[model samples]
Target chain A: MPIIVNLDVMLARRKTASKDLAAAIGITAQNLSILKTGRARAIRFSTLAAICRELNCQPGDLLEYVSGPEPEAAEGGE
Target chain B: MDKIQRLSSRLRVLFLAGMVSVPVLHAVGWAFFERIMATPPLNFSSIFGLSWGEPPFMAGPATLAMKLLGFCSSMLPGAAAMYGFACLAGLFGRFGKGEMFSAATVRLLRRLGWAVLVAQGMQVLHGSLASLILTMGNPPGRHVVTIGLDSATLAETVTGVVIILASWVMDEARKLKEEQELVI
Candidate 1:
């Protein structure tokens, strides 16, 4: 499954450092990393709004649909 | 029964037995010791001096009933909570299913972490009360037992906090690693 964070792209487009982006978004750089890498299982609406506003991008820019594991192979392998 | 089920049952039985026996033994011992103390000319002072303190609590009459009930009410819940947590961890171990290093578990673990911090707050509250009671030089009634109760409660709380914090740290690291992998 390709889980796209779009953070690196967003940083490139805006010409913003990760540290500055994080500071502008009022979140710790570490938390920004958590979001950028798709390690987060869920994100708060407020945080999502904040990220969108700071990055000057829509929510779709931050998230991507990815194929999850194939169910038959997963069950059989398990 | 499966092996895990059998073991868990046995453990539960053993836990109950210990809980029943220890307090009963203590109560009986207290009674016997008090009886010996009541008898006159029992000048075996040196041998029993180690136990010499305020009048030993007796296990008879209405007073004893109240004391025993009060003691059990104060102490048993704390022991039960510890035992409950142990049983939970054990059950999880048996299934080969641990609290996964996942976001949900992390949140739950954080709650448990906060509980531990709250327990420490409780200890502080208890210590302040104990100090006040001591300085006031009031007769030791419920106040003395309160300090002892707080100590018992805090001990369990500390254990819970440690377990919660350990789990939280592990989960946090796991989350970070997973994030890194996504980046790669």
Candidate 2:
């Protein structure tokens, strides 16, 4: 959940519509929407590669890792 | 999957028919069985298929009471069987709709488990009561009461536990499926 999809930012920068990107990447617009909204459970490497190729961006540009709050120490921790 | 759906549809019809018929059959049979089956002289041996090793302990009032009690004892568990079957029929209907991992399916399966388990318990009670009544007038030390568990009861117990376990598994699967759907 901490790994966020930044697909929308790259799509906007490239001036490419989601429908066009979906067509180019050989995926449904709905599936692309899921990826764009960060609702996808996982992205296949092949699909990620295709999206990057279509968007003229690297994988890092389409994904962002945000650190969550630190967990409390365990009861027995030193 | 299509074939499974088709078969489930057919099974749904059969189960529904059975559900409808059980109560109707019991009603008709209960209503007419006494009149149609009770012949003169009323040979208890032929009627019950038991050799008592002596004459039946039938008197005027006792015989009537015995007959009525037997009818109720037999029919009580018969009604329970109908209820159990109805739950099974409802479960089949859900399956027919292809709602395999639904809350409704889980409810029906749980109901079926309870129905079967309770019905089997009632059947055992009925058997014990019948045995007791039939041996009521036996001489001292000659009477016997049987509250034994047999193969049928064992099978029903296993079936009820399996059905309940399956329902629990389905409930877990449904939750997982919902979470997976939310992922997208």
Candidate 3:
């Protein structure tokens, strides 16, 4: 995915634990881990809003768009 | 969900019974072939829609060999039915465990579909073979060869194709569910 999730960086900057953020955002710890590791297919707007509210940050601060070949395409080319 | 599980459990048991009974019933029918033909009400000729011809009264090697061959050929359809029933039992077992959209369930459903088609095809083949075997004891030039197709067989073929298509659609649904679960 070209779109990267910077949830770990935001959590660290806000001095928030992943478990506490998950509980506050009304999601499971595994789901929060999925978001942090960029394994999620897509995040719901409500969940994004909840995460932003919990960390006191903007959506842009949590998500970053980097230009590069897709991981699958890169693997296939090799 | 609980209701689905309960219903699935009951259906699983029913399919398991069918899986066990199919072959046993075929075996019993073959073992008492002459007696059943002698009895009007219990005659398989009416059930299978084929003339069983005159049963051999005296024991002969040729007649016994033909009967044995018929019995073995008859087991083809029974075995196919048993496989279909077993697949249904496994599919319902998964449903009972609340894995309704799992890949294993879809695979079992697909297998059941193929089994149904194979069973129907085997039935057609068995019918012709059985007719020849039953008439093998007749005088020369008096032998009978029969091939039959009824509406029931056609309906079963359509049902099998529909099941295979439904399993394909279920596979797509399973993929979508997996993707949805991955979304936070």
Candidate 4:
């Protein structure tokens, strides 16, 4: 996706580990990893807000729009 | 949830019944299937219970082969119909359980459609062959090779095609459901 997640960068800049940020944001570390790695399909407003509040960062700082080709679809076969 | 649970339970029972009914029906058919395909289509003694006479059982390879062919002809349609019903029962069970947009249901529907067509095809083939065998021994100018077809065959074939098309629709619906699931 062209709309990439920059959550790992924000977490790094704030000097917070992924586990600490996920706990502070009231989300599981697994979900935080999904968000950090840009694997989430869509983010809920409440979740984004909570993450922003916990990390003391704007949504813009957590998300970035980088012009790129569409991501390939997941492979499936019989 | 209560309603869905009840429906799924009922559908599951129905599916089981369908699976069992197929063989039972075929067994019953086997008992009388050959007799029903007798030369005159039904012997008078059997109708009147006059000793329940049997069709003149064949002795030669050709006649025995014809008998075997008749049995196959009778069993194929029954098998096809049973298979088709089994698929439908499975499909209904899935629907009742709220797995409406699923690949399994679509596959079942597709199989049901194909089964119906196969049953009809087997029926037509059997009918033509059975008729030819039964009437082949007639005197000169008695062999009438009629095409194996009837109103029921036509209707069943059309219904099968419609079912196949319904399966295609289900396939599309399943794809949409998959996309929606991936949207998170």
Top DockQ: which candidate number?
3
Poorest stretch of ten by lDDT in candidate 4 chain B = B44-53
State the lDDT of candidate 1 residue by residue for B1-184, as single tens digits.
3665556556656655654654454445334544544664653221221113233232332244433433343233333434444444443343333334566545545555555555455444434342332223334452332233345456767777786777778786876666544331
Can you list each candidate's DockQ? 0.05, 0.19, 0.51, 0.22
Q: Which ten residues in a row are the worst by lDDT in model 3 chain A?
A: A69-78
Per lDDT, what order, best first? 3, 4, 2, 1
Query: Residue B13, candidate 3: how far off, in angstroms?
Result: 1.5
lDDT of 3 by residue, A43-64 (tens): 8999999999999999999999
Compute the lDDT of residue A55 as modeled in candidate 4.
84
Report the lDDT tens digits of candidate 4 across residue range A1-78: 788888888888889999988788787887778777777766778888888898888989988899889666752211
Model 1 ranges with Cα > 4 A deviation: A1-78, B1-64, B79-87, B90-95, B104-160, B180-184
| Model 2 per-residue lDDT tens digits across residues B72-169 | 66555566667777777777777777778778888888888887788777767766665555556566665545565667678988998998898899
Supply fnat for every model shown. Answer: 0.05, 0.19, 0.90, 0.24
**Candidate 3: residue pairs that collide:** none
lDDT of 3 by residue, B42-113 (tens): 776522325344443333334567757777878788788899999999999999999988899999999999
Q: Spell out the clash pairs found in candidate 4.
A: none
Model 2, docking class = incorrect
* Best-performing candidate as measured by TM-score: 3
Interface RMSD of each: 9.1, 9.5, 6.5, 6.8
DockQ of 4: 0.22
Error of 4 at B152 (Å): 2.8
- lDDT for every model? 0.52, 0.67, 0.81, 0.68
Model 4, B60-105: lDDT tens digits are: 2234544455455556676777787788788777777778778898
